[model samples]
Target: MSGSGNVHLRQMARQDVAAGMELVQAAGWNQTEADWNRFLDANSEGCFVAEAESTVCGTAATIIYGHQLAWIGMVLVHPDMRGRGIGTRLLRSAVEYLESRGPLVIKLDATPQGRPVYQRLGFEPEYEIERWKLTATPSLHSAPGAIPLDDDKPDIEDVIALDAEAFGASRSALLHSVHRDAPEFTAAISAEGRLLGYTFGRHGLHADHLGPWVAEDQEIARRLLETFLDRSTGRCLIVDCVKAHPFAATLLGSAGFEFSRPLTRMVRRAVQSGRRSGLVCAILGPEFG
Candidate 1:
């Protein structure tokens, strides 16, 4: 444990999931209990929580993708405990723990309120991403070439390969976990059994999020999104899309998803090369990114 006063930091455990959810919920975040589970499952040793008088007051978790990179997320503190250094302490602990695994680069999507803190910690902007939402499902037409990716179809290895190319990190484990968790919303575009593009969805507390969405062309991207929207009708939906993508803004707007907020994708060290940002229409989520 590390802290002063009544606050102390410790490794998070499965039993702490509910308390973690409270912190996220108190912040009006879209994360669900399942999201909390993903963090703990991804790296239990990297998930840390701050407790004040034995109550969870803050949290910070990290997910390492091989030795090349690590993602810092869920750096949330209870509203009643803001400005008490709890958030900073939790973040520092997370970074320190992740650093112990070696000098892997750390990245996160920063909110306007949290960007300065990250900047002071040596993070620099990589690119901008935006959260778009659809409150009411729009009228849709089926795109000609889109196909359903069911449990029995689409080679998982191929999906991971494309995702790695687009995301610049091999997150096969994360992608597989997402498919296992919510396979109903998965779809792909293919020609002669060769994968061309794909998308996966997640069920969240606030809404259903569509992402890790990648495509080789605008039409494929549109079809993948259309498939998700058709299946996700009537539910609150969200997409954290790359602002620089040529088709992201237009596709979202045409589908009735309006701009919600802007997020800055920041890296702790210098930005690495090979990130195919253009092919990534939408990210899995800010937390995952």
Candidate 2:
């Protein structure tokens, strides 16, 4: 356990899921109880919670991708606890934990309010990301070559490989978790029997979130996105898109997706290699990426 003054930090447990959900809901975040569970299930020892006077007041979670990369997310502080140093402490705890594990890179998608705190922790801006939303069904034509991949299908491995190439790290575990939760939202595009792109989605509290959307080019990205949108007709959808990607803005705009907010993709320490930024149209989510 770690603490400063009245604020105490400890490893988040399964029992703390409800408390975590309360913080998420209070922040108007899209995460559900299941999302909280996913973090604990992924890395029980790496997730942390803060307490003040014995009440949980803040939380932070981390997911390490085989020492290549680690993600810090779900950092939250209760409204009443905002002015204290709880958030910083929680972030520090997460960073320290991830650093101990020897990942080459640590990353987080920072809200404007959290950017400065992250900057102070030695995180440098990587790129701008935007959350785009579609409230109504998009008028999308069928993506003829795109095919759906069920969680149990043999093709799922191909999807994982394609994703690893684009994301620069292997996130097969998270991808499997997403597929387990929303298999209907998983799709891929292939040409000449080779995987070109893949996309995954998860059910959010208020919308269907599509992402980690990767492709070889704009046309492939569009096809994957169109497949997702076509399947998610009449439902609210969200995509956290990389601003620098060539196809994101145009595709999202044409599909009637309006920009919601900006998130900065920040990285701690230097990025060595293998990040195919051009291939990644949207990330899984700010919390997961």
Candidate 3:
């Protein structure tokens, strides 16, 4: 356990779910209980919480993908706990735990407030991703060419292969979790019955986030997005788009998704692979990145 003053850090337990959710919600983040479950489900030992006076005050989570890379996110400290060294302790705990597991690279998408802290910890900038939001669903005048993925009988290999090339890591299990949780939003755009592209997302309490969104071209990307938005109508939607891709900017901008904030993808002991901008329009989210 790590602590300073009254705040102390310890391995997060199943009973901490409600308190953990309160920390993230207080930060006005998009994560839900399901998101927290993703981390705990991935590795219960990898998540941590900070507490003071028997109350949770901060949290951090880590998820490793196929022993290749690990991502740290949902790093939060209650407003009352900021500047008390609680965030640092939680972040350090996450890094140390993952380092013990020996992933090639450790990464996280940092907000402006957290970028300097991560840089201080030796995380170098990799790329910029912007959170784009669509207040209202995009108009679906033309029928989408893509079809909803048959959740019961999906071509797992095809979906995994396409995502692996675009995402730079084989997160077949993560994709399976996303699809199983929200299969209605999982879709594919094909031509001549050949897989052109695919997309998957999860519903949050405040909004629905579309991510790990990949495509063969802009048209396929467009169709897949429309299908997701149509199902996600009446709810706030968010997509974290890579700034390097002009097509993503144009497509989202044209669809009325305004830029909200920027997240810098940072890595420690950086790896050369893992960025395929032409095919990857949006990422799975900072937590899963």
Candidate 4:
């Protein structure tokens, strides 16, 4: 454990989930208790919490994607504790943990409010990502050609391979965890026995989130998204799309999604060539990416 005046930092424990949720909820974030558990389950040693007088006040978590990439997320500080440098400390701890693991890249999706802090810590902007929201009544019928993923599906391994190509890392564990959480919302598209695209959805505290949405083209992306909407009818839907993608924003706009917020994708070190691909229409989430 480390200390900064009255605030001290330590590895996050399962018991801290409720406190972590309180902080995210106060910030109006969409994370749930399950999300907290996901982080702890993936990297218990890398997630940290800050406490003041033994009460949790700040938190940060990191998940490494092989030795190639690592993501830092869920950085939250209680509103009452904002100016005390608790957030900076928490972030520093996360960085140190990731650096020790020697990943080639460390990345995070930064809100406007946190971008400056990230910049000061040597994170440079890579691209812009936008959150889009769709509100509509759920469709009663599933979109044709959108097949649900199952453990027995022969193409399941193909989906993971495709995701690794688009996302720039092998995150099979993360993908399987998401499917286990919401199997009904996960779908894939294939034709001629070849996988065309796939998507995974999460039931957030306030909305149904679609992401890590990948496809060979816009049409497949649309089909996957439509299937998610059909499965999660009458719920607010959120998608964090890659702004640089040729068709992502246009497809979302034509489908009646409205721009909700902006996020800057930042990296701590220069990215290697051929690590990522244009096939990623939307990211898993700022937290996961």
Candidate 5:
């Protein structure tokens, strides 16, 4: 761990979050310690920080969620460390680790500058989404069918089942970590207790922006969003959508959401699968990008 020493990329320690935050901010992303903790808790030991002679220099995190999908995010290198291969190596190490867990559908949200690096690594573009902003506070928009925040406790079992169904993999442990700090989590339901759609969010929790807003019915989905925003405070909300959640994205746009930054959802099918369409809707966490 000396200046002249080789690049040493390894798991991040809590102390690294402060140094890592500087690198993330300098890189122009609002990565905070809360975000780091969430990432660390999600896939324990999967958070990484690179250092040189007692100074933390680079950071990245890999989230292996619901089992099959693994995502890489918060990839940052100190301005001074850019010319070295630290960023690239840190990324590779993360991918290798996920690959070891089992088959994976690896994906990452790429900044314009990093897109080419990922493309070179065999990931193909799936879709691009604009991050929307809410210009003004709208009064709580709620409809009768929208469900209230349930379980003063997070529903581990239902969440596990629904999340697994959505992602097509089982990852309760990782999901358990996600449950720890969820402030607002809602499930859209009909007059009966059928699971129409659901949205879970954690504040001061990593991926602080909530989403994956889904409802079997588009209108119900929109109403759920209204309740979601009405209950929270932030200039806006952000979400990633695939073709399946057509109305979900449309509703956000209509509600004054604006693109703070948009990202390309890319994936490398380095693992085998029956088909991808089924799990596309459940790719919940932004960390999995």
Candidate 6:
């Protein structure tokens, strides 16, 4: 019911799914209609989409976590609408709605272009990071001392609990979502049965993306990552590592992992209490913000 020069911002409706997803791909975020629909369907509280002249112009979603935190999502702008303030308006609406509801502010990872806009809106840079992915052989065989987390029903909940403690965020749903029926992903533990580390990922159409690779230490982290590559064999194995972490540069560099993409985990004031580098893989996902 809103329009501005053919541009309108409002909550996304059930009918908006297909067109909204088409717009998502056109915005160059590398997501699909199915992905967009699933995201919106899961988000009952809401999603924000902007339409221009009855066509999809932009879309973003907010997934509220326990009424105390909300994660921003899929902020896309039409290719033709670049620099027209469509995205800014969509993002602003999301933040404003969240702030008014009082959810300790919000957080999101931004692409280079998205970074500047968020910065202008008071979002702060979180330790200069990049989402690095590589698909070689699975690291399972090559990484020394690498043992699968699920070998004997490895306590997924325990690993998730450790992750929540390290990242200082409520991620049970996230852990459940990523680990459910996804075998390409993996978790690593020490010989002494200590909760060492893990990598969450899935096989996508183009490539397999492993994110949120967290660990107890550099050695364990290296083993977990190396295991992924070794297990991949002829297949492509992917991982997203944070530059801010202590051994990310060294380990990835040693493994010949190149920086193919750059993204930022942008944050605004009334900040949520969590350390992205402490026990993070890739800030969960850039698209999830």
Which candidate leads in TM-score? 1
Rate residue 201 of model 3 by lDDT. Answer: 91
lDDT of 2 by residue, 205-242 (tens): 88889998988888877777877876774568899999
Point out the higher-scoring one by lDDT: 2 or 5: 2
If scored against the real structure, what TM-score would every candidate get? Answer: 0.94, 0.92, 0.92, 0.92, 0.80, 0.84
Candidate 4, residues 1-289: lDDT per residue as tens digits? 2344678899999999999999988999998898888889898999999998888989999998877889999999888888778888899999999989875699999999889888989999999999998875434235564445543253657888888888888899888888889877778887778888888889999998999889899888877777776677457889999999999888788667889999999999877455557888999999998
Which ten-residue region of model 1 has the weakest summed lDDT? 143-152
Model 3 C-alpha lDDT versus the unseen true structure: 0.83
Q: Which residue runs does candidate 2 get wrong by more than 4 Å?
A: 1-5, 141-154
Clash tally, candidates in order: 0, 0, 0, 4, 5, 20
The residue pairs found clashing in candidate 3 are: none
TM-score of 1: 0.94
For model 4, the stretches where C-alpha displacement exceeds 4 angstroms are 1-5, 136-154
What's the residue-level lDDT of 108 in candidate 4?
Answer: 97
Taken over the whole model, the C-alpha lDDT of each candidate is 0.84, 0.85, 0.83, 0.85, 0.63, 0.67
lDDT of 5 by residue, 1-289 (tens): 2353566778987777888778867875544576687678787577888878778888779877565677888888788777567778778778788888888788887767677777877778876755554546544444453446563233457656665566546656655554565545444444455455566655532234555554566666676676677666654445555544456556766766655666677788854354434333323444544
Give the per-residue lDDT of model 6 (tens digit) for 161-275. 7766666566677567666635557565745667667766655435556666787688777776776665553454444567667787677767766677777777777666664
Evaluation by TM-score, superior candidate among 4 and 5: 4
Clash pairs of candidate 2? Answer: none
Better of 2 and 3 by lDDT: 2
Q: Please say which candidate is ahead in lDDT: 3 or 5.
A: 3
